[model samples]
Target: MPFIDLRAQYAALKPSIDARIQRVLDHGQYIMGPEVQELEQALAAYVGTQHCITVASGTEALLIALMTLDLQPGDEVITTPFTFAATAEVIVLLGGVPVFVDIEPDTLNIDPTQIEAAITPRTRAIMPVSLYGQVADMDAINAIAARHGGLPVIEDAAQSFGASYGGTAGTPRESGSAPRGKSCGLSTWGATSFFPSKPLGCYGDGGALFTNDAALAQAAREIRVHGQSQRYTHTRVGVGGRMDTLQCAIVLGKLERFDWEVAQRLAIGERYQRLIGDLPLQRLAVREDRDCVWAQFTVQVDHREAVIESLKQAGIPTAVHYPKPLHRQPAYEARSRAATPLPNAEAAARRVMSLPMSADLSEAQQDQVVAALRVALT
Candidate 1:
C-alpha cells in the first residue's frame, strides 16, 4: 500500500490535469502566467478570503507571511513545537525567537490556554498549527490574541486547507447549524502547503497565503516578487516566493474534483476512526466544531516502532508525521523558548504514527490495515 497514494489521485484526475498542463505550456508564460491569477481567484473564493497569494513553496508561504508582518530581530512568535519544523523554522529564519508551547495531549494541537502565559512585550505573533488535518482551537486563540494588543495570528494550515473551523461571524459553530468558514479564511494569516501529500496538493512545491486584510495582502504580493512595489523597484527585503504558473495550473485542475475529494477524505477519516475504536491504540481527538481532512490519519500507539515494523512486514505502509518535536531537534532546541511544559509533545513524538491515508483509500484497504495492526499488537 502506498503511504499517500498520489499516483491514484493523478490517475483519477488525469484528463483535467493534462489539459491544464497543456494550456500552461501553450501560453509559455511559465512565470506568473494567467493560470496563477486564475488559481488565486478560485482558491480565494473557495477559502472565503479577500486575497490569496500563491508562493513558490509552503516554507516560502510562511516566510513571506512573517516578512509582511515585518518581524524584527528578537521578536517572538508563539507556536507549537509538535509540528513540522517549517512551523517554527520560519520564525527562526527571520532572526526571531520561536516561543514553543505544548500541545493538547488528546488533539496534539497547540494548547490555546497555554498561549497567553507565553506572551511578552516581544511577542509579535501567535501561530497555531492545524496538525494531521485537524484545526487547533482557533476561536479561543483568536480571543487571546485580541485581548493582547490585537496581535496577528497565523494558522499553519498546511495540513488543513479543506478543513473547517466551527465559528463564523462571531457565532460558535459547534452545533454545525451555522456555516463554518474554511481554514485559511479564519485567521489574520493562513498558510497552507501544496506538497503532494497534503489534502490540496499541486504536482510540485506550491503554497498560498490567505487573509482578509488588504494592506497585509498587498504587502504579501509585493514581497512575493522580490519585494517589488513596482517593476524593478525593491521596496523591501523579500524572497523570490511567487508560485510558478505551471504549478498553479496543476492546482486548478485538481480543484475540479476537490469538493468530492474532500468529502471522500471526511468519510474515510470518520470510517478509520470507527474501525480503530477497539484497537489497542489511542485515536487523535477531533473537535466537534471542525473536521480533519485526514492529511495523515494518525493514531497513538505503544511500541510505535514495533507497530511500524510489523505493518511494514505485512506489506502495509506507515509513517510518523513527525518523529521528533522541533524543540528536541538539534537546530531548534537552543533557539526555542518554552514557557509551558513539553512533556506531552515529547511523549507524542515517541508514540504517534500515521496510517496510510488518502481520499482514494478504500474500505477493504483500511480493513486490511486494521487487521494487520490488530495482529501486530497481539
Candidate 2:
C-alpha cells in the first residue's frame, strides 16, 4: 500500500496531463510559457483572488512574500512552532526573527488568542500555517493584525490549498453553508505548496502566492523574477523563484477535475472521522464553519510507534506530518520567542500520525487502517 497514491491520480488524469505536456514540449518555451500565466489566471479565479503568482516552490513563495513586504534584519514574523521547518526557515533566511506561538489542541493550528500578546514594535507580519489541510482562524487573525497598524498576514497554506473557510467555530451548521473564501484568498498573502503529497499538487516542485492587494502582488511578481521590472532590470535583490512552464502545464491538467477532487477529499475525511469515532484515539477537530481537504487523514493516538509498526505489519502505511515542533529543533530553539508554554503543540507532536490518504484511497483501505489501529492499540 502506497502512502499517497500519486500513481493512481496520474493514471486517472493521464489523458489531460499527456496532452498538456505535449503542448508544452511542442512550444519549447519552457522557461515562462503561456501556460504559466494561464495557470496563474485559472488559480486566481478558483481561489477568488485578484492575482496568483506561481513560484518555484512553496518555500520560495514564503521568501518572496517576505521580500515583497520589505521585511528588515530585525523584523519579526509571528507563526506557530508546530509546523514544517520551511514555515520558519523562510523568515530566518531573510535575517528576520520568527516569534513562535502555541497552537490549538483540537485543530493543531496556531492559536489566535496568543498572537496579540506576542506582537511587538519589531513585529512585521503574522504568518499562520493552515496545517494538514484546514485553515486557521483567519477572521480573528486578520482582526488582530488590523489592530496592529495593519500588519500583513500571510497564510502558510501549504497543506490547505483547496480548504474553504468563513464558518464560525464552536457553532452549529448554518443552512446552505456556502464557502466564504478559499485558503489563499483570505489573507494579505496566501502561499500554498504543490508538493506531490498536497491536496492539489502538480507533478513536482511548485507553489503560488495569492493576494488582492495590487502593490503587493506586483512586488511579488517582480521579486519572483529576480526583482526585475523589465528584462535584465534588477530593481531589487531577489532569487530564482519562477515556476517552470512544464510544472504549470501539469497543474493545469490536474485542475480539469480539481473541484471534484476537493469534494471527494472532504467526503472521505468525514467518512474517516465517523469510522474512527469510537476508536481509542483523538480525531482532528474539523470546525463546522469550514471544511478540510484531508491532505493527510491524521489522528492523535497513544503508543504511536507501536501503532505505526502494527499498521506496517497489516500492509497499511502511515506517517507523521511533523514529529518535532520548530522551537524544539536545533536550528530554531535559539531563534523563537516562546512567550508562553506550548503545551498543546508539544502534546500533539508526540501523538499525531497521518494515515494513507488520497482522493484515490478506497473505503476498504480505510477500514483496513482502522482495524490495524484497533489491533495495535489492544
Candidate 3:
C-alpha cells in the first residue's frame, strides 16, 4: 500500500484542483498573484491569527520567522532535540545557538518543565515542535515564557496543521472558522509545512507563518521579498522565500475539503491505535484536551530493524519518523548544546516507527497493516 495516498487525494479533489490551477494559468501571474493574498487571508482567518505569510517551503517559513525576531550571533533558542533538522538548522544558519532539551516520553514533544532551567541571558526564543501531528503544551510553555520576561515562543508545527489544543471536545468548528487553540494560532509564531504529505498540502513545496502580531506580520512580509518595504526599497536583508501563486491556488483548492480530510485522519488514527493496542508495542499518547491529525500514525517497537524487514517482506510499507536525535547527528552535535541528558529522546529515536497513514487510508488497509505488524513482532 502507498505510505501516503496523495494520488487518491488528488483523484478526489480533481475538479476543484483543476479549476484553481486553470485560473492561475489564465491570470499568468505565477509570482505573487491574487491567489497569494486570497490564501493568506483565508489561512490567517482559519488559524485565528492576524496574519499568515506564505513562503517557498517549511524551512523558509522557519527562517523568516527567526529573521523577524532579529536573531543575532550567539543568541540561544531552546528547542527539543527530537524534531526534524530544519528546526535547529535555521537557528545555526543565523549564527545563533540551539539549546537542545528532552521530550516527554509519551507525547514525544518538548518537555515544558525543562524549558525554564535552560534559559540563560542569551536565550532569545523557545521553539517547541508539535511532532507527529499533536501540538505541544503551549499553555504551559507560554506560561514559562512569560515568567522569563516574555521570551518569544515559536511553534514548529510543520507536522501538525489541523491539530488543536485546549478546547472543549465534541465542538469542532467548521473549516474556515477561526476557533482559538488551532495548531497555528497557539503561539508567538506558528510555522507549518504544506509539503505534499502534510494534512493540508499543496501540489508542491509551500509553508506559512501565523501570528497575532501586526508588526511582526509586516516584518515577515518584507523579509520574504528580499526585505523590500516597498518596490525597490531595501529596508533590511532577507531571502527569496515567497510561495508562488500556483502553489497557493492549489492549497486554496485543497482547503475546500480540509475539514473532512482532518476528520478522516483522526478516525483512522484512532482505529489504528485500537487495533494495535492488544499487540506488543507502544502507541503514541494523545492528551485529553487536544487532537492529533496523525501526519504519520507512529508507534514504538523493539527490534525495529527486524520489524521493518518482516513488514517489507509482507508487502507492507513502514517508515521511521526519525531514526536519531538531532544532537546525535554529526552536523548538529558540534553546533548544538544539550540542556540535559536526553534519555527519552535517545530511547524514542531507537524504537519509533510509522505505518502507512493518510486520510484516504481504508479500514481494510489498516487491518492488513496491523496483522502484518503482529507477525513482525513475533
lDDT of each: 0.90, 0.90, 0.92
TM per prediction = 0.97, 0.97, 0.97
> Which 10 consecutive positions of candidate 3 have the poorest summed lDDT?
169-178
Q: Write the per-residue lDDT of candidate 2 for residues 13-47, one digit (tens) a residue.
A: 99999999999999999989999999999999999
Rank by lDDT (best first): 3, 1, 2
Sequence-dependent TM-score of model 2: 0.97
lDDT at position 48, candidate 3? 80
lDDT tens digits, residue span 1-378, model 3? 999999999999999999999999998999999999999999988888889999999999999999999999999999999988999999999999999989999999999989999999999999999999999988788888888998999999999998977654334434543334789898889999999999999888999999999999999999999999998998989999999999999999999999999999989999998888899998999988788999989999999999999999999999997999999999899899999889999999999999999999999998899999999998
**Which regions of candidate 3 deviate over 4 angstroms?**
170-180
List the pairs of residues colliding in candidate 2: 167-289
How far residue 65's Cα lies from its native spot in candidate 1, in Å, is 0.6
For model 3, what is the error of residue 7's alpha carbon versus the real structure, in angstroms, after optimal superposition?
Answer: 0.5
Off by over 4 Å in 1: 167-180
For model 3, which pairs clash?
Answer: none
Which one is best on lDDT? 3
Number of clashes in every candidate structure? 0, 1, 0
Clash total of candidate 1: 0
